[model samples]
Target chain A: MSAREISRLVVPNRGQSVWLVLLSASAMAFLAVFALALSVTSAQLARNWSAALAQTATVRISAPPEEIEAQTAIVLEVLRTTPGIAEANVMVAAEQAALLEAWLGPDLPLDALPLPRLIELTETEEGPDRQGLRLRLAAEAPGAVFDDHTRWRRPLAEAAGRLRAFALVSLGLIGGVTAAIVVLASSAALASNGQVIRVLRLVGARDRFIALAFVRRISSRAFIGAAAGTALGMLALRALPEAGGNVHLLSGLGFSGAGWLLPLAIPPLAMVLAWAASMATAFKLLREVT
Target chain B: MIAFEDVAHDYGGGPLFREVSVRLEPGSFHFLTGPSGAGKSTFLKLCYGELLPSFGVVRLMDRDVRTLSRDALAETRERIGVVHQDCQFLDHLSVEQNVGLPLTATGRPLREADLSDLLGWVGLGEQAEALPPTLSGGERQRAALARAIIAAPNVLLADEPTGNLDWEMSQRLMMLMIELNRMGTAVLIATHDLQLIRFAKAQVNARVMRIAGRRLQIAGADL
Candidate 1:
């Protein structure tokens, strides 16, 4: 009865307070995986959606006003007739103006700046043959140049991949740190209860009974800590402002639908770690005194 | 039952006790009287398997003290009850819980009423839930006695069980030990109180042992 009661009294009153352990575990859990969550999802979105951007190429025809319309028509015709080219559309003046406005100042008059004629090409299911398409376009409209967005996409995707890897490494480091802290906490608790153990032995308590008290206490404390940390982590993620180029990537980091329940697992998993570590430490330290 | 065989003990290579041997039988009481630093407590520690003899085999309940595992040692302790001169109580626990410690520790479930009745037997009915630190000297001794017999251990070992108690309280404590011996519990009292030893002999057959120069010897006295 006293053993069971001692288990009840472990964190909140007796040794390391429950709130402190819970808070510490929660902090560790949140920090451990936060970077990983961001990196992995960002990498996934980048890898999965990059093909959509890569499927089609755009042509810009730069020439005099009279020749601009002529070159644009010629580029569109080349794209439509080329093998692996499914569709083509010469950009309307309004679409070109909007695209330019994103880079240039919004107040710039589109008529004042003699912007180039742009033609968008769609690749067939078989995919566009880049060399053939480029040759055809150059022969038809010498002023037309193809842009496949090579320089931008490669670096972006590579950066996303690196971020994911970094996140995973961070998660692993956090786990190691958590284990270290738990080991220290368990050891301290075992030390503090040294006299209690001696008394228990004097009263004829088996080592197993004495060990259970510590294992249960530390485990329950870790569980509480992880739960609070996870809750706060979710809350902080939800409160962040999402207005950037990778808004979808940033916001999409968290679980959705059935995946939302996955985050709830961290507490029990942490408890398991605590139980194992504390149980082992308790028994080992108990071997000396009892 | 305990047997000490040519036991020699040393701390930092300085002898606390050496070449000592004693066999204490069932239903017997031994008073190990000595001045301070005479190894009375050391001899008691050896008897209960709290400390192993450095040179000899000390056996409790027919098992080598040093050979037993932690759990085995715990089970061995179930057959022994030790009360310190200070009556080392877990001050946070109530008087009843303190007395019931041995039972709880050994996983021997005790009924609430029985626990209450045991406290009543010790005449601490009013202080049953009171903390050990708050108990008077006599109450602490009685509580210690209650704890010693709560599991009905075969051997009861006390280091000056009534050193803090007044004369009448000491008499009551001695009477309790004699009663336990009458019921076949081998009781060993380590104290310098000759009066208590003399009082013990009047009720039950007791043997007197003395500690001098780190050795224990049976004394030539009425006890």
Candidate 2:
């Protein structure tokens, strides 16, 4: 049958199950948007952290105040001579003081506190061998410790990866729940309109024709609901207070540039899901009726 | 054409009818009469592929109903129109849409002129906009008839087509069936109305068959 004609066969207000489907679709879309944003942001954070920290190391020189400058020079010399170390520079005293000011009060006298000297090292792509660097530092500057940031970077990167995994899993669960709701609602609609289906079949309506009527109705509803939910989700994300300068995770939790198009895909995906669920339900019910 | 070869059906409550065989040829008119619960509806269902024969074969247009795929069966059904006693309809649709349902179902574009003509033919021209729930029993029956013939099927099966109509309406409906038969459309009407059978016998060359004793037999010299 023509879609228009077949559509007219179902009473528009016959069942409330469609509302259940709409509600479920909207809820799923809302959750899915957030999940998608979380996953994308977490992945970006992990990538940034890995890239920024993977080829760098730090050298801390703690010695008697009289020997600090000499040890710092020794650490720099060792790093510059290393095969994979690209550059090494001692941090300025003011920079070291600023780093310690957060722990001590800003008014403290920095130079009198016997602060350790810090050296920043930039390594080549094939970075320095940590064991060799540590042995060299221990002999030449007994107080020097070589830290490649693995202890800190590993945990932060792992945490971001876990968050990304969790968000993806949430998205999958939301999709599954949406599909389940659509199937249940479609089955209820089929049962409620059992007589309509029977009449259509009696008039020689093919299964495709009957299923088209239902699939179109359901999928359209899902699309509308998902579109609304996605819009609201985007707005909610927009309304969040701007992240503070250091809160990279919060700043990365929403889309930018082409990433805005990702949420738009949710509505169409919802329609496809609803279409499949409704078609399967209609054909199965029609089979049972016959 | 519909043919039954020793067809039998059971509802798991033991067989309702067994070893029943019949064939409906093109341009033929048949009256199936039987007592209540004697499998008249069951027989019609088997003829239309709504129910499969438990022990034998029922074929529509030379294809065994059992072997026809769901789509094939649907295609076959488009050529065979059926009218139930209940005059089932999508209650939300207007009478006009219900009457033109066959064409709609077959994906044929509905012609306003043809629908007007068919409704006028069934005496429902004025009631075309009425919903099924608002229709009288006789009006419903005429609408059902109009729906059954909208596609101009090769075979028309009506189960108690005039069961809910007055005598005059019943006669009017029967005349329409006879006209369809004369136009080379095979007709099958299952009814217990002896008077309607008598009325039909006088207007057309029709065979009256009775379902009794778990068998189908042509009643000789009955009317």
> Which candidate has the top score in lDDT?
2
lDDT, candidate 2, B104-172, per-residue tens: 766888888999999999899999999999999988998998998898899999998888789998999
Candidate 1, residues A1-290, lDDT tens digits: the string is 65466434322247564445666788987874466457646766677657757777788888888788778767777776777878788888889888888998678888888778778877777877777767877788889898876766788788778777887787777666767677778788778776666677777878787788667887888988888888887777666665344436655665445654656777888888878877887788877763
Off by over 4 Å in 1: A6-12, A15-22, A29-87, A107-151, A242-260
Task: Give all TM-scores, in the order shown.
Answer: 0.85, 0.94
Runs off by more than 4 Å, candidate 2: A1-13, A83-87, A107-112, A123-131, A244-247, A250-252
- Native contacts matched by each model: 0.57, 0.66
Model 2 gets an lDDT of: 0.87
Lowest lDDT sum, 10 consecutive residues, model 1 chain A, at: A6-15
DockQ of 2: 0.61
lDDT of 2 at B118: 91
Model 1: clashing residue pairs? A11-A18, A22-A225, A26-A225
Worst 10 residues of 2 chain B by lDDT: B99-108
